[model samples]
Each structure stands twice: as structure tokens, then as C-alpha cells.
Target chain A: MDNYIEIIGFIAAVLTTAAFLPQVYKTWKTKDVSALSLPMLLMFFIGVLGWLIYGVLIDSPSMIFANAITLVSSFLLVYYKIKYQK
Target chain B: MDNYIEIIGFIAAVLTTAAFLPQVYKTWKTKDVSALSLPMLLMFFIGVLGWLIYGVLIDSPSMIFANAITLVSSFLLVYYKIKYQK
Candidate 1:
């Protein structure tokens, strides 16, 4: 059961992390941040930080791995929001 | 400690869940989703489903609680993406 749960966690991690790919690509291509919410980006960055801490606590590599990528992506999103805010 | 870990999870949950507020608000006001990615939303929904399953398996109320809100929000995001694709 635990193994299955971990497998689910890994798959979840991949899906969630991969989901950001298209967003990043679109943003990179369009360079539009108007529809993107600045506060939401910041909030998500902090949220992912909390998740990272929780992952560290639980010693779950999948959680840590997923949140790490998310954190980086959130940071880039925030950076994009700030840098390209019109 | 498990208690502390749970606290972190809760905080993460709140942060991640609440991050959607501004997006929801802006989308409701403008009804624009050009910046939103449909494929991303679908991937997120699946990811959250996995998370929800993992949450149930682990019996982590915080995980379950957080992912449930995210799942609903992602669905709405998807709905918005499909409904308002101009």
C-alpha cells in the first residue's frame, strides 16, 4: 500500500511539474503578463516553500522533488511577473 | 515531530489553496483565459487527483483538504479556459 502510494505520489509529482511547461512556454513566447496575477505568483511561491519544508520533514523524496521544481518555476513566474509588468 | 510536520503541511495547504484567489477574481472580472493553458489545467487536474488519492491513503487531513480545493479550482480554471477562448 505504501509503495503504491509512493508510486501515486511520483506520478502526481510528474504531472504537476509537467503542467507548468506549457505555461512557461506560452509566457516565454507571448511575453504577456497581464492575465497573470502577481499576488498569486508570490503566494504560490511561498506555498511551494511550505511544501518543501513539509517534504523535508516527511523525508519523502517525491514530495521534495516535486516541490523543488515547482519552487523554481514559481520563482521564475514571479520574476517574469515582476520583470514584464506593464 | 509529526505535529510540526502536520503544521507545515497545513500551512502549505493554506498557501497553495489561497493562491488561486486573485486568478479567480481576475478571471471572473475579465472572463479572459488566453493566458491560461488548457493542457496545463488538464494535467493539473490529473495531478491533483493523484494527490487526493495519496492524501486519502495517508490520512493526512491537510493534504486531502488542500488538494480538494485545488482540484475544484483547477476544474473551474479548465471550465473557464474552455468557455472563454477568444
Candidate 2:
């Protein structure tokens, strides 16, 4: 049961982490982020950092992997925000 | 140092977890989800569920709290998506 649950965690981690990629791609292609919020992205970046700490504390690979990717995406979103501001 | 790190985790958890509120509020008020991605919200929901499981396995309150709140918000986003489709 634990293994099954762990697998679920991993699957979820991948899905959530990969989800950010498309948005980045969209922004790169369209360069339209009029709907995106700067404060939200900032908060998200900080939050991902927190999750990184939590992932380290718990030593969870899923957490680390997901947050690592998310951190990069959110960081880029900050730059995108400045570049593509409406 | 460990305690300090844990505090950082908790703080991150709160910021990330609470960050969704404004979007939800904006949607509630404006009924706008044109900028929001349905697939992204769905992926986020599943990922948060995974985090919840990971939190349980590791006995981490911050993880649980953050994921729990995020799960609720994402679930509502799904509903909001259905209701406010562009």
C-alpha cells in the first residue's frame, strides 16, 4: 500500500511539475502574460523555495524534483512578467 | 538550523498555499478564467494530492496544511473552469 501511494506521489509530482513547462512555452511563443499576476509569481517563487526546504527536510525526491522544476518556471515567469508586462 | 529550516518550510507552505486565493477571488468576482488553463489546474490538483500523501508518509504538518488548502482551491478552479469557459 505504501509503495502504491509512493508511486502515486511520484506520478502526481511529474504531472504537476511538467504542467509548468507548457505555460513557459506559451509565454515564449505568444509573449502575452496580460492575465498573469506578478505578485502571484513572486509568491510562488518564494513558496517553491519553501517547498525546496521542506523537500530537503523530508528528503523526498518527488518534492524536490517537482519544486525544482517549478522554481525554475516561476523564476522565469518573473522575468517574463517584466518583459511582457501589459 | 533544522528548526529554522522547518520554519522556512512552513512559511513557504503558507505563501504558496495562500497565493491561490486572489485568483479564486478574481474569478468569483469577474467570472473570468480566460487566462487560466484547465489542464494546469487539473494537474495541480493531482500534484497537490500527491503532496498530501507525501506529507502523511513523512508526518509533516506544513506539507499537509499547504497541500490541503491548495487542493481545495484547485478543485474549485475546476468548477470555475466549467462554469466560466471561454
Candidate 3:
């Protein structure tokens, strides 16, 4: 069961982390952050940042890895939104 | 450090889970699931479901709570996409 848990955790981390990739790709490809909502992005960025901090504190590598990548991807979207959005 | 971690986890949970709300609301209100990509939503839904299973295995309330709400929101979006989209 414990092993199963770890496997699930790993799977969860990989999938969720990967889920953001398309949005990241779309944002990168089009350079169009207009469709993205500012408030929503801000909330997500902050949320991921918090998750990163939590992972660091918990000493959970899965959380750390997932949140770190998510943070970067989300942060990029926020940056693009600010830079490009009119 | 531990206390800080818990706080961060809570914060993370609140924000990320909340992040999905606007999309849920928008989908509910506009009934415009057309803009939403089916593949992306499916990926996200599976990811969140995996996360929820991981949370259950780990006995982490924060992860459980966050993913549970997210699962519902994402699932709703998926349902709407299939139901309303042309």
C-alpha cells in the first residue's frame, strides 16, 4: 500500500505538472496572454509558490518537484500576461 | 520551519483550488465550453484525480482538500464541455 501510494504520488506529480505544459506552450507560441485572466494567473502563481514552500518544509521531493516546475510555468504565464496584455 | 510549511500548504491549497473557480463560473455562466480544449481538460482532470488518490494514500488533508475541490471544478468543466460544446 505504501509503495502504491508513492507510485500514485509520482504519477500525480508527473501528470499535473505536465497538464500545465499545453497552456505554457500555447502562451509561448502565440505570445498572446490576452485570453488568460490576470487575477486567475496571480492566484495560481501565488498558490504554486505556497506549494513550493510547503514542499520545501515537508521535505517531500514529489511536492517539491511538482510545485517547482508548476511555479515556473505559472510564473511565465503571469509574466507574459503582464508584458503582453493590453 | 514545520509550522511555516503547514501554513504554506494551507495557503497553497486555498489558492490553487480557488484558481479553478473562475473558469468553473465562466463555463457555468457563458456555457461556452468551446474555448476549452478537450485534451487539456481531460489531462487536468486525470491529473487532479491522481493527485486526489495520492492525497488519500498519504493521508494529507491539504492535498485531499485541494484536489477534491479541484476535481469537482474540473469535472464540471469537462461535463459542460461535452454537454454544451458544438
C-alpha DockQ of every model: 0.84, 0.66, 0.79
Q: What is the C-alpha lDDT of each candidate?
A: 0.86, 0.83, 0.85
- Candidate 1, A1-86: lDDT as tens digits: 67888999999999999987677767777889886788788888999999998888877777889999999888988888898988
Candidate with more favorable, higher lDDT: 1 or 3: 1
Clashing residue pairs for model 1: none
Q: What TM-score would candidate 2 get against the native?
A: 0.88
Q: In candidate 2, what are the lDDT values of residues A1-86, reduced to their tens digit?
A: 66776687688789878767888888888899887888888998899988887787767777787888889888888899998896
**Per-prediction tally of clashes:** 0, 0, 0
* Model 1 alpha-carbon drift over 4 Å, by segment: none
Best by DockQ: 1
The alpha-carbon lDDT assigned to residue A64 of candidate 1 equals 89
**Candidate 3: C-alpha RMSD after superposition:** 1.6
Instruction: Name the best candidate (by lDDT).
Output: 1
Worst 10 residues of 1 chain B by lDDT: B20-29
* TM-score of chain B as predicted in candidate 1: 0.90
Runs in model 2 with CA error above 4 Å? A1-5
Model 1 Cα lDDT, one tens digit per residue, B25-79: 6776889897677887899899999989988887777789999998988888898
After best superposition, candidate 2 residue B16: deviation in angstroms? 1.0
Error of 3 at A38 (Å): 1.9
Clashing pairs in 3: none
lDDT of 3 by residue, B5-70 (tens): 567788899999888798899889999877788888888899899888877776777888899999
